[model samples]
Target: MRIVVLAGGIGGARFLRGLKRAVPDADITVIGNTGDDIHLFGLKVCPDLDTVMYTLGGGIDEEQGWGRADETFHLKEELAAYGVGPDWFGLGDRDFATHIVRTQMLGAGFPLSAVTEALCDRWQPGVRLIPMTDDRVETHVAVTLPDSGSAAGSGERKAVHFQEYWVRLRASVPAEAVVPVGAEQAKPAPGVLEAIAEADVILFPPSNPVVSVGTILAVPGVREAIADAGVPVIGLSPIVGDAPVRGMADKVLAAVGVESTAQAVAEHYGSGLLDGWLVDTVDAGCVERVEAAGIRCRAVPLMMTDTDAAARMAREALTLAEEVRAV
Candidate 1:
């Protein structure tokens, strides 16, 4: 199968590992979310891209679900010693080398998609990982600051880098608005729309629907291409048992007025964008409601607790797609 998946950071990367194991012969393409991309210490960091690369490249710390295994903090500690800190997110020495190369290439006038290709040449992430767009789009969260700076949503909106809101504040405060800066003008990166057009199947992994997959669709021609593609487009639920299986998804889900529930999440994407929907067994009761909305719905174990579990989920998705095509 020529499979294309829209993905976020950790969750997306991990799911891809299982996907690879499930369909070793399939040509997999990942359209990764770059909204979390940020400039830190004068280097451009592509968290989702690196996460997917490391995980598939077999260099990832299986337990941490991110960064390299046997990673050291020497570079971080040295930066902290010099009073250069935002020490909240750990950018290891080895991981730092990736950003350094990417930053240099970008500085030399290469767009992010090209720089990412250059980086991928080394890791060979197995699946072809294309960024949502070549444009510089950054996801920003609007948060209120306290008078004493304790924590309060300012009546006036202030935008902070997504990493500051996620890794630093840890999504403690409500996000009034989430914006993908520059998305309005961004064209889909070279191969993005083409991959969608040619793919036999398209998937929305257990990624943050509002940010990760949503940001990718926000780019011009991306959603339209998928909609126009004559193939199965399926989505796996990120919300399980009325809560996110992982991450602060509820906070961001609410920013888009989506209730944190399996049914609501499927409804949020709507029948227009998805051909099939997979919700956890715990949410099977909502299957009828989802099918009523014009999507082929199935209740299954959607959690990716391990590689085997994720592979099972991938098999279920394939089965659903085949069933839909047969009908």
Candidate 2:
């Protein structure tokens, strides 16, 4: 089967690793979340895309879940010594190579999609990794700054790139609004719509809802394509229990007024788009509520502590999809 997965950063990337192992023979296409792309030090850094690439390419820092393994930070130190630093986000020497290459390619009039494809060629992430759009759709969060913050002119809310809101401020500021600045005009990249149209299954990994998957779906054609894809669309819950597995999902979730719970997340997506939902065994009680919402729901161990566990989670999601089809 051909599977298309909507993904975020580390959590999403790790899930894909297991999904790949679980469905070894399936044709997998990963639609990476590029919302975390930020311009820093004259380089474009796509955190989610890089995480997915590194994790699957077997060059990821296993613990951090992002950047290159066995990385050094001499370049970062030099930049610091030069008094040019946003030292909050750790960009190691080896990892800096990716940002440098991506920035160089982007400056040469290549869209992000093409640059991503070129980078993937070397990583060979074992899947067709496609950007949702070649068009720039940098996700930004509006938040209260520590001092006087100038507004982005998008609206009254002061805006910062997604990464700055996430990595630098650590989501401590109140987010008034989240916007994918250019998604409204974005066109899906080559093979993106086609892959969705031809996909037999689409999986939503445990990613941040409002910013990660939400940002990708915010691209005009992407969400509509999946809703009309005429295939099973399954989702794995990022909100296991009442908290996020990683990242500052709770803060963002609250910004949107959605309770950070499995039930609340499923309801947020709603039956309008999702066809199947999977939760952890601890949340088995919520199965009925999800099913009552007209989407199929099942309970299984949802923690992805290791590859074996993640693969099992993937298998369970696929199994639930089959069950949903049967029903």
Candidate 3:
């Protein structure tokens, strides 16, 4: 089977791991979100891409669910001592090498897609991982920030990189707006459109829908390619029973003006791009609403508590795809 999956960071990575195990012989292509990519210390960092790479390659830190296993932070510590840092965003020594190599290759004029391929040669992530776009497309959030010296006054609204709002502020502030800067012009990375065109099944794992899958769709032609592909394009809802299974998806969802509910998220994707949608059993009430919106819908276990559980979810997605194709 040929599978194409749109993935974000941790949740996406974990789901890909299970998908690999579920269909061991299937050819999988992951279109990773690059909107979260940020430059730090003059090095480009692709967080979502690295997470998927490490998780699939068995080098991911199991506890943190991101970064490398057996990672050390000597580099981060040294940078902090020099007072040169975005200390809130932890880039350990092991992870730093990845950014260093990527930045070096980027400086040599290699597009991000090519650089990603070279990096994956070492990890052997078991899937063809292509970024959503080789061009720079950053997710920025608008929020209210209190002035540094003002003691008592309404804060001013300001725009910040998605990482700062996520890693530094922890999404505590309301995201008044979420913008995918440059997505309108970003071309799909090499093999992205081809993979979608050839896929037997396409999946939207329970990654943050707004910043992850949504960001990828923001790239020009990507959404149109999948919608017109004439294959089963299914999604597992990240919003399980009215809340995200992981991460602060609700905050971002709100920014997009979508309610934090399985039905609402399915509707957000809509029948245009999605053929089938899966909601957790706890959200069984939403199945009819989603189906009524002209997309096939099912209620299933949606948690990726472990590889086994995630595999089951993968199987369910495949089953749903088959059901959609049969129609």
Highest TM-score against the true fold, candidate: 3
Shift in Å, residue 309, candidate 1: 0.8
Q: Which residue pairs show collisions in model 1?
A: 144-152, 144-153, 144-154
TM-score of model 1 relative to the true fold? Answer: 0.96
Error of 3 at 143 (Å): 0.4
Which window of ten consecutive residues has the lowest lDDT sum in model 3?
146-155
Q: Write candidate 1's Cα lDDT for 120-139 as tens digits.
A: 99999899988999898989
- Model 3, 150-250: lDDT tens digits are 87557889999999999999998899999999999889998999999999989999999999999999999999999999999999999887999989999
Per-residue accuracy of model 2 over 1-327 as CA lDDT, tens digit each: 999999988888989999999999899999887777877798988888999999999999998888889999999899999999788889999998999999999889898888998999999999999988887788888886654564444333478888888888888777777888998998888888999999989999999999989988988889999999988889988988888878878888887889998888988988888999999998999999989998899999999999999999999989987887777
lDDT scores for all predictions? 0.89, 0.88, 0.95
Report the alpha-carbon TM-score of model 3 versus the true structure.
Answer: 0.98
Candidates sorted on lDDT, descending: 3, 1, 2
Q: Residue 65's C-alpha lDDT in candidate 1? A: 83
lDDT of 3 at 251: 100
